[model samples]
Each structure stands twice: as structure tokens, then as C-alpha cells.
Target: MDINNTLTIDGAIKEFAPQIEKTSPLGWSWITFLSVLVLFGFYGLYTQIAEGHIVTGMRDNVVWGIYIVNFIFFMGVSYAGALISGTLHLFRSEWRKPVIRMAEWITIISLLIGPLYILLCIGRLDKLHNIALFGRIQSPITWDVIAISTDIVGCIIFLYMALLRDFAHLRDYPELKVPKWKKKLYYYFALKYHDTPEQRKKLNRTVDIMAAMVIAIAIIVYSVLAWIFSVTLQPGWHSTIFGPYFVIAAVYSGTAVLIVSMYLFRKVYKLEHVITELHFKNMGIILLVLGAFFGYFTFSEYLTKWYGSQKNDELLISILFDKYYWEFVISNYIGVLLPLIIIGIPKFRTIKSITFTSLVVILALWLNRYLIVVPTLESPYLPIQDSRSAWVDYGGTWVEWSLTLGGIAGFLLLFTLASKLVPIVQLSALVKKDKSEENRKSE
Candidate 1:
């Protein structure tokens, strides 16, 4: 199938079919690399399970370590996916079609991976069910549990709805060169969608409804996560702004991830025609706006703490500025400002430059999550007066670092496998839009 053929539904199927039907040698090599990281992560998990929390850097004073940081970071990314995709769909943005599927995938994949970190954080995994069995209404933990559970279901439905037309198209495509089982899989999931006007109306309506619901759910769920910290009596946490603060940060990081994903898929799949420089520029603008808001929120948060001058707040701020000085600067200052500079300057807003800036934003946001989790724990309300440095300071051990890498590899691996199952770009939407334009030209 010549990819340069005029834009049509059949042409799109032929163009995207190779993505599903065959894996290149480089693709297999990438998969192997990710698999190795995942296996190593599993080994780390096994060691943690066998040896208990003693082997980890977590102590009584610093009970939450990188695991909690990862949990919050991944959840933030997931919520950002939900917010961006939903808003784009609601507004019926034309440029969003190519990237929306990637955003949806980010939402589902991050949701799957994010909560696993909570399990890693729990010392007693055997009694994990107690959160559900003996949960209280007033508990933020309980709220998070319910909110995340609801969010997973909502996002899955939203993604499935988004994919339905593509599934039906693949199922019906005579030229689709895939295994019988794969075809059957598509047929079953396609739900007898025949592209009729009625079916189209119903599908569009359902997708629109799910989009709105997931957006609302994502906000509520992340806010609940923030509340889990804010409602606490601890310094650097008991603030009124943490909810909005977390939400803004999540969207900022999520936008960066989405941009990175778009860049990778566009390059790998050779989708320059579909995902153009304009898409990157549009997304970069969004990232710039988010970066500015995130920076403002970070300043507002710390400025309040510094001005209020409570002893615990003072101590926590001092720890952040003194002990975690480099991290504080990178995450709050460099991470936020660099992306703004890259995107704000017209000369620097090329696709490659924006993508590089996004990568920096991602690392900075991860560091931001670390800063939020670790330094605050180090400066607890009741200080641990211990001679042992391990008791006083928290550092991620090899096991924690391995698991973190593994979680990241797992996210990438899932995205890789998902692309093999369906088109990363929404082929149906693109074809439909192309047809609409053609019709208008004919008229």
C-alpha cells in the first residue's frame, strides 16, 4: 500500500495496517530492552517481598519514599491525560484527532501503572484489603480508593468508545493482514458497529458523554489525592492550595508526556503527514500556559509558607531550601522555566526543541514529586532525634530505583503493545474529516 495515496478510509487502513500486522526488527529490539527492565523490576519486587521494608530506605520517620512519589507522579500524569483529551474532544478541535488516541492511551496506561506504586508502598500487602473492609467515610485514603476505582472504569469506557469505529473498520477491512485470532478479537470488541448514521450518532454521543465524565472524575480523584496530604497536620502538606496545586502540576507533566509520546510515535511510524509541526506547536502552546500556571502555583505555595512563618513550616521550608537545595531549584525553577522559555521563544519552538523541553519538564516534574514527598517527610512535625543518618534522612535504595525504572518501562511497554493492537492515530476520525473536506470542495 502506497502511503502517499490520497486520503481515504481505505488508504488510512492500509497505511496503519502494517503497524498492527508486523513488527520491525528495531521494534522487537525495543521490546526486548523494555522486557529486560520489567524483569529486573520484578526481581526487585520479589526481593522487597521476601526481605520486607528493612531492605528499603524507608524508616519510621521517612515512611514514604520514592514509591509514594512515583504513585503521585503517575496519577498526576494520568489525570493530565484525562483533562487534555476530554477538553479537546469537548471542543471538537481538529488538530486533536491525531494526538487524542495517544492521550487516551496515556490515561489508561498511567492509571494501570500508577496504583501499583501504592501496593509497593504498603508494608503489609497481605492486609491490603482492610482499606476496603474497615474503611471510614472521613478517611482520605478511603476517598482515594473509591475515586481511583471509579476513574479506572470511566477511563476504560472512554477509551473503548473512542476505539470502536477503528475496531469496526479493521474488522471489516478485506486487506487487513493480521492473524485470524486478531481479527476475531476486533470483531468481538467492535460490537457490531456498521458505520450507519444511527450507529455513528450513538457512538459519538456515548464518547462525548464518557469524555466529560472522565474529565470530571480525573479532577475529583487527583484532588482527593491532594487532600490526603493537605488534610494532614504535617508541615509542607497542610495547605489549602495543594488540591489545585497538584492538579496544575499533573496537567503540566501530562502535557509533557503527551508531547513526548506524539514525537516518538510520529518518528517511529513516519507519521509526519498526520502529526505535523503545527500539532507540536499547538501542544507546545498548551505546555507553555501550563508551565506558567504551575510556576505561579509553586511560588504561591512557598510564598505563603515563608510569609506565615509557623515554626514547622519554617523548618520544612529550610529543609527544602537547604537539604534538598538542588532538587528544589531544578523542579520548581529550572523545570518550570526552561519549558516556558523554549515554547515562549518563536525561534526555539521547533518540534525537536519542544520535545526536548517536554523531556526536561517530565524529569523536573518527577523531581517535583520527589521534593513534595521526601523533604516534607524528613522534616516531620515531631522530629526523630536519632543519631543514625538513615533515621534522619531518606534515600531510595537500589531496589526502589529498580522498581521505579521498571514502572516506567512497563508504561512504555504497554504503549508499545497497544500500538500493535490498534492505530495510535485515530484513522476513522482522520478519514471522516478528510471526507468532509472533500465533500465541501465538491459542493
Candidate 2:
């Protein structure tokens, strides 16, 4: 074998496989911790199911609660997977290699867990099938259903296609001590991908086509989610810019979560060489731009309503500016400002700071979603005639809080198991990239 090819193949089998082939003590502890949280989440779900929606803080006035908030957050995070992977592939960005597999994992895991919030929101599991049976084109909910379903299929295809080469690598590397069942699984997933020049060309072409398709599909899917809110007559949600606003926010939060994940994996796997400062800088820059876009949208959204002074819009604005003043300011202003400072100021742009900023942005964006959903519902144009205190204010109950944490745990659990099952970095893609760079340098 040629020296370069030998090195690439050796690295794939030795470096990448060892990282994934076994679980560490820390890994087991992490899984157990997440499992405990999931159990708590299931218990909360049981109470909500047995006792009804009353266990949640949602009322007739404020119908949507933390469940809807979490649904939006998870769905938004899923975009990080599609957008980052698709954009990097399209541009052929060198920085994307270290993080691409993690991005896809985030997307797959988020998609799997995000919809559970909807199930929680539904209150009655038996009526779930009614969505498909009675869904109409006129409803934004119907549009969301179709969009999520389509995106899930598209994401799975992209993820599987991306995994094929890694599967093939693991299959051929018999010394890796992988279980017999896992070896068989890898063989099946690899689809008998024996590495030949012709097969390699076909794989590249297919990935390119799918990458383009997924980018478009992911954008539309998230936009449809925004439309689910904007199409409504609610004061805060009824805006033409809501689609772009949502898409931007999704990318923002998704990127933040990606950075956080990148930091954790880098430390745990000791991939200092593979995931370096340059990747953090590039992703941080992207986050900076997104944070700016988010700030602009936030300003525009409130500025328009503040200018118009429409009674309903004004009331909604008051709730955001006055009642939920701290949350709005923190999630919007502080959230955007902190990241901007961390990324823009050259001195503060360390991996640790970037990851910290990302954590803040992720949490703040969740609060932003909560503010978007609840406060608007509280200040309906028609005054609250029910005269119930609970109907006036909606604070999430223990059941909602527990289930929210559970959903988060579930997302973490999926990602953890996935990391163990496959190479968290796409070794084949990295090899091809390295070879391309070498060829260019030689030329």
C-alpha cells in the first residue's frame, strides 16, 4: 500500500475504533446518571398521564407550556446537525471535519427526543393518531407534521450515508475486539462497501446530492415550525419575519450546543490534534454572526410593535418588557451580547469561553421560547373573564419541569450511546480531506 493510504487506513482502525469500541468507567457513570433522570421524567409523565394536564401549569388561557417550549428548543437544536453539516460540505470547509459526526448525532438524537414533548403536550396518547387521520392543509400544525416527518427521513438518510464508510472501516478491522453482533450490524449498515475507485466516486456523488437536498429540507422544516407560531392570530407570533427569526434562532442555539459538545468530546477523547482551536474560532465566528442576526430580529420584532401601538400588540409588549422584563432582557440582550463579546474580542475567544458563551446562549434561547409562548397567550385581546388566578399566570409545575429535564437527559443519552457505537469523527472524510490537502500542497 502507498504510504499515505496506509497511514489513513491505520489511523482509521487504530485511533478512531479504539475510541468507540469500548466504554469507559466515566461513560458508564454518565449513562447511569442520564438513566436516572429519564426515570424521573417517566414518573412525571405517568403523573401527567394519570392525573391529566392539570398536573402541568397550562390552563385555558395559557394552553401551551414548557412542553411546547422544550419541543421548540429540541427542534431548533436539530437544525445544528443539518445546517452545520450541509453548509460545511457545500463550502468544503476544513474546520467541519472534527465536528461533523457530532453534529449529525445531535440532529438524530434531537429529532428522536424532540417529538416526545409533543406527546406530552397532547395529554391523551390515544388521540395522537387523530393528527394524521384528521390533519388538514389549512392548519399550521398539519404543516409542522409534514415538515418534521420529511426532515426526519432526510436526516436519517444523510446520517446513514455518512456512516457507511466508517461502518466499512470497522468491519474490515477484525483486531478491534468489537462484539460479534456489532460486527454484523456494522456489516449490514456498510452495505458491502468494498473500497474500490469506482465505488468511491459513486459515494462522493451521492453524498454531494444528499447534502444539497438536506440543506434545503432542513431550512424549510424549521421555517415551517416558525410558521406554526406566526400563522396564528396571537399578537407576539403574528409577524412576517417570524420564519427567518425562527430559522436564525434555531441555528444559533444549535451551534451553541455543538460547541459545548465539541468541548466535552475533545477533553474526554483527548482529540487535541483533531479538534483544535481553529475549529472553535470558525464556529465561534458563525455564532457571532448568528447572535447579531438574532439581536436584530429581536429589536425589529419589538420595535415594530412598540411603534404601531396596537392595543393587543402593546399589551403583549408590556408583558415582555415589564412582567417578564428580566427574562426577555437576559435571553435576548445578555444572551446576544455575551457571545458577541466572547467571540468578537480576540483575547476572550478561547475554546472555554466560546463553550461557556454557547451554554449561556442555549439556556437563554430556551427562555426566549418560553417568553414567546406563554406571555402572549396570557394577554389575549379578549379580557380574561374566567376570573381564576391560575389562568392568569402560568408557571411550570413539577411534572413539566421533571419531563423537561427528562427530555434533555434522553437527548444526552442518545448522543452518549451513539458516540460509543461509532467513531465520533468521520475517519474516512478526514482521510480524503488530508489527501486532498497533501495533493494541493505538492502541486
Candidate 3:
């Protein structure tokens, strides 16, 4: 069982076998913590179901609240994952192999969780089916439904294609110490793949096609989400730039998330050899570039509105500066600038610093979505007279807060469970790369 024999399935199994077999106490602890949060979130959901939207802070004047913000933020992150994974795979970037699995996982898990927030936003659970059954093609909500469904299906196919070879390797490896049920699962998913030349050719072609399709679908889907807001008559919402603006912000936050996941997996699994500083450096450069573009979009969006000085736009801007001043500054300015500064400067770009910058960007992006949703709703074109402050202003209650935290925990829990099931790094890719390098050296 020579693990150095890169030409064989044995190499990949030997290298990644430990990850499948081992779970640290720390892993269990983290899982337990996430489970607690998830339960708490369910409790909040139960309360909301029993007591109704009255348990939440959403009101007639400000209908959209934290739930919508979370919905947008998660969907943005999911789209980001799809875009990054598909683009990297299409371009055949060598460095992408290590982190690509995480990106795909982010896409699927976030896609699964994000739409639940929409259900939370809906006051009537019984009428949920009406959206699909009676949905108008002319409506933006219908567009969103169609786009999300298409994107998720494409992503799942792409991810499954990407995983097939690895699944085959795991199934064939006699030394793999996983349970019999797990082995059967792998064998079932592997689809009788034996890495024959014909099989390889077909798999590669399918993956390549799926990769290209997912990229196109991801952009269109996320753009459709932006159109949902931009098509509305609200003051801040009715902007032509929202489509590309939202896309840029989504990729920005998604890249930050990829970096954070890279850091965590590398630290926890002791994968420093596989996920190296060079990978961080390359990804950090990407983060920096996206941050710059995001900053430009932010500046352009506000500049156009401020320079135009329409009465409704002016009111929205005033609300942003006065009521949401800190959020605006932190999300638009500090969130966008600090990552650029940290990653752009050669001296400050340590792995820890980059990870911290990513954490900051994630929070800032969430806040960015919050500002986008709440303030615009608060400063409606027609004011509701005789409304109380709580009714007029949007604020998240304990229930919303609980569910938000639960969503984050659910993401972590899913990712953690996924790691136990499959090697976080793409084992088949590593094996192929190693074999190629060996052939080159021999020649």
C-alpha cells in the first residue's frame, strides 16, 4: 500500500483516509453548539407560527425586515459560490482545486437554507403553494422562483459531477475504514465508474459543460434577485445599477467566505501542506480586486442619487446618513476599504489578518443588505401618518435574531457534517495532479 503511488486510487485513500475515520472532541463540541443554536431557532419559528408575525418586529409601514435581509445575504453568498466554483473550473485554475469543494458546499448549503427565510417572511404557510401554482411569469417573484430552481439544479449536477471520481476512488479503496453503509452510499453514487479512459472522457466533458452552465445560471439568477428590488417603485430600490451592484457585492462576500472556510479547514484538519500560503495569497488578491470594484459601485450608486437630488432619493439618503449612519459607514466604507487595505498591503497580508478581514467583510455585507432593505422601506415615498415609532422604524425582535443566529449555525453544521462524509479537499484532483507531476519529472 504505497501512498506515494499517485497513479493508483491507493494514494488518494491513504492521504485522505484519516479525515473520514477521525473526529476530534473539538469537532463534536462545535457540532453540539451549532445544534443548540438550531434548536433555539426552531423554537423561535414555532413561536412565530403560533403567535404570528406579531411576535416579530415587522409592521405595516416597514414590511421588510431582518428576514428579508438574511434572505438576500444568504442568496448572495450562494450565488457567489456558484460563480467562483464554476469560473475557476472553466478557467482550469490549478490553485482552485483545494478550495473548490468548499465553494460548492457553500453553494448547495446556502441555497438550501436561504429560501427558508422567504417562508419566514410569508405570513401564510398555507398559501405558499400559490406562488408556484398561480405565479405570473410577468412578476419578479416568479422570475426569482424560476431562476433559483434552475440555478440549484445546475449546481447540484455540477457538484455531483465533480464528486463522482472521488466517490469511485473511495468505493474502490479497500483500506478505507468507513462504515459499511457509508461505503454502500459511495458505491451507489459512484455509478459504476472505474476510471476507464472512456469514462474519464465522458466525465470530464460533462463536468466542463455543467461548470459553464452553472456560471451563466448563477449570474442570471442573482441578477433576477436584484431586479426584484429595482423594479419596485420605492425610493432607494428603483435604481438601474442594482443588478450589477448586487452581483459585485455577492461575489465580494462569497470570496470572503471561501477564504474563511479555507482557513478553518486548514487549521482544523492540519492541511497546511495542501492549502498553502500561496493559495491564501492568490485568493487574497481576488478579494482585493472584488473589494475595489464593490467600492466603486457603492460610490457610483450614492453619487448618482445624491447628485440627482430627487425628493424621495434625498429623503432616503438622509435616513441612511442620520438613522443608519454607522451601518452605512461600516458596510459601505470600512467593510469595503479595510479588506482592500489589508490584502493590498504586502506587509499586513498574513493568513490570520486575511481571515479576520474576511470575517469583517461577511458581517459588513450582512449589514449592507440590512441597510439596503430596511432604510428604503422606512423612508417610503408616501409616509404613513399617525404611525408609532416602532411601526415606522424597522427593528429585529428576539425571534428574528434567534432565527438569524440559527441560520448561521445551520450553515456551519452542514459544512461540518459534509466534511465527515467526504474529503474536504478534492482527493481525485490531487491524485491526478501528482501523477502528472511524476510523469513530467520522469520524462
- The local distance difference test score of each candidate is 0.91, 0.87, 0.89
**Estimated TM-score per prediction?**
0.96, 0.95, 0.96
User: Tens digit of lDDT per residue, candidate 2, span 1-443?
Assistant: 21222346546568777677788888889999999999999999889888999889998889898999999999999986788898898798766877899998998899989987988888668888988998788998998899998989989999999999888878777688878889899989999886666887998898888889888988899899999889888899999999899989999999999999999988988888788888899999999999999999999998998999999999988888898999998899999999889899999999999999999999899999999999998888777775598787899999999999999999898888898888788777667444432443366
Q: lDDT order of candidates, best first?
A: 1, 3, 2
What residue pairs clash in candidate 1, if any at all? none
Candidate 3 similarity to native, TM-score? 0.96
Q: Which stretches of candidate 2 lie over 4 Å from their true place?
A: 1-7, 432-443
Alpha-carbon RMSD, each predicted model: 3.2, 3.9, 3.3
In model 2, state the lDDT of residue 317.
84
The 10-residue segment with the lowest total lDDT in model 2: 1-10
Which scores higher on lDDT, 2 or 3? 3
Worst 10 residues of 3 by lDDT: 1-10
Off by over 4 Å in 3: 1-8, 433-443
lDDT of 3 by residue, 166-274 (tens): 8987887777889999999999999998766789899999999998898888889989999999999888888899999999999999999999999999999888878
